[model samples]
Target: MNMPNYFELFDLPVQLPVDVSLLTANYQQLQRQYHPDNFATANDNDKMVMVQKSAMINDGYHTLKNPIKAAEHLLSLKGFDAATEQNIIHDADFLMEQFVLREKLEDIESQDDFVILDDFHSEVFARQHDVYKQLLEFINKQDWEAALNQIFKIRYLTRLIEQIEKLQEKQYAL
Candidate 1:
């Protein structure tokens, strides 16, 4: 198989904030084009080529569809090792803030305090605004490195929201 271009791999613009509908459409198109059945009458080599392309297409679909995943992929693409840096998490104040908020969340569980969830959501949303402002700066300066750094923090906040949702589900299921 040819080295896959991002456009051909995701079948979308090599652009940020990809259009969801178009991404899905392109994915379906590739599935039809590269289905193994299309190569059924071809030689074994051709069939293997089709199999490989299909796998790449599927992987690309996943990476481009989610913002957090896309940011991680983008950082890797730019040769930035976010995981290698301890500096991002080296903010002692921020670490203490997270610990305090987590304790508050745990305490509110017994109170069935929906207000605590709202407060957490509001706090994250507020942080998102700051992150977005930084994102704008990165975009203005064309600094993929800064954008990549802030994006990782955004992903961390997103994961917290997902955890809250899961906790809500488990609580309600009881």
Candidate 2:
């Protein structure tokens, strides 16, 4: 079966950092066109087809919405396989930095001062932003390995932030 590429489906240029306004407009238009309710009176086979098409459109919209997902999709379209398990980050310095950050996050629970936790959260956010900047550079150069490494860093930072937030909630409940 012939399937439209996500960029083509959304009438977007096949590139990173897509125009979000155009994507949202095109997504809404596609939803309206393929909405199953519009085919309520059709036969079961046609309804099923519409449901599948709607699902595909929704999936494309979501994938293009998130930066990391969009980068991965672009890489896949360019024939890059993200062998994440095999493609370990080899930058020893970066890994050491990550180790230090993780150690700080793990030690947060031992601190009694809420101010320290707040400062740590801000620090992690700044680091995450730095990772995002690095990711953009790698993506522009089509350096899939470096980009994936940055993606991994961002995911870790995201989880770290969530853990900090959960701790804050628990502290507030006390």
Candidate 3:
């Protein structure tokens, strides 16, 4: 059976930046329409179908809500399965920057200053934002290769931010 993509299921455009309010409204509407309780009085086959549709609605909502997942889904719609693609970025400058960031993160953990961690978090967030913009631009131009690279950078920056937050939490628990 042919199935609609997440964007189609949500009645949304296939883009990275999705409208959260609309997505939430549509998700609630679909949940009400397809919730398993609504099919309790139906036939066995009908109940099963409703359960499946409800699951699809939930999965579509989550995949479209997350920027990274949404970007990956967009690439998949373009015949590029990013999950399985081995698109390794070999840019030296990018690699060096990541390495330096990691070193700074390690050093921040040993220090007792919250300001350092805050600054690091802001830097990583800014870098992630920049990469996200580039990803959007590349997706708009159909430059899948570049978009994939930017996705990797965004993922790395996200990880760095998470790590910084963890360190900050650890320090706070002192």
Candidate 4:
């Protein structure tokens, strides 16, 4: 089966930061065009095709909506493999920084104060934003290696932020 290029499907440029408003509009258009309800009276084969098209549209919209996923898609379109298990981040400094952040998160988790958790959440988000900016710059320069490294860092920071948010929720419930 031939897979459609998501950028082509959305009439979008193959870039990191896609035009969100345009993407959303295009997505809604596609969704309406291929909605299963429209195919209710169609033959089985045509109905199946519409369902497949709708699934692809949903997948493409979600993939393009997320920055990391969009970056990976862009890299894939450029013939670079997205992060695989083999593509380990070798930056010792980044690894060390993540370790430090994890330690801080643990300390905050042990504390009863919501203020510290909020502060940690902010710090993690700032770090994630910094890495995201670097990823954008690297992608613009076509520096796939650096961009992949930044993707890894961003992934780590995202998980850390999620953990902090979970802890905050738990604190709020107390």
lDDT to native, each model: 0.69, 0.83, 0.87, 0.87
lDDT (tens digit, per residue) of candidate 2 on 1-174? 643489988989987787889999999999999999999999999999999999999999998998777877776676665544344667788779878877886787787568888899899889888888888889889887788877777777788889889988887788
Please list the residue runs of candidate 2 whose C-alpha ends up more than 4 Å from where it truly belongs after superposition. 1-4, 83-87
Clashing pairs in 4: none
TM-score between model 1 and native: 0.75
lDDT of 4 by residue, 1-174 (tens): 544589999999878788999999999999999999999999999999999899999999999998889988887777666765355789999899989999988887777789988988888898899899999999999998788778778888888888888899999998
- After superposition, which runs of candidate 4 have C-alpha atoms over 4 Å from their true positions? 1-3, 83-87
Worst 10 residues of 4 by lDDT: 78-87
Candidate 1 clash total?
0
TM-score of each: 0.75, 0.87, 0.93, 0.93
Global CA lDDT of candidate 3, please?
0.87
Q: Whole-model lDDT for model 4 versus the true structure?
A: 0.87
**Model 1 misses residue 73 by how many Å?**
2.1
Clashes of each: 0, 0, 0, 0
Instruction: List residue ranges in candidate 3 displaced over 4 A.
Output: 1-4
lDDT by residue (60-165, candidate 1, tens digit) is: 8887787555555555556655556543654467567667766766776766756676677678667766775675567457697777667766666666666667
Looking at model 2, the pairs that clash are none
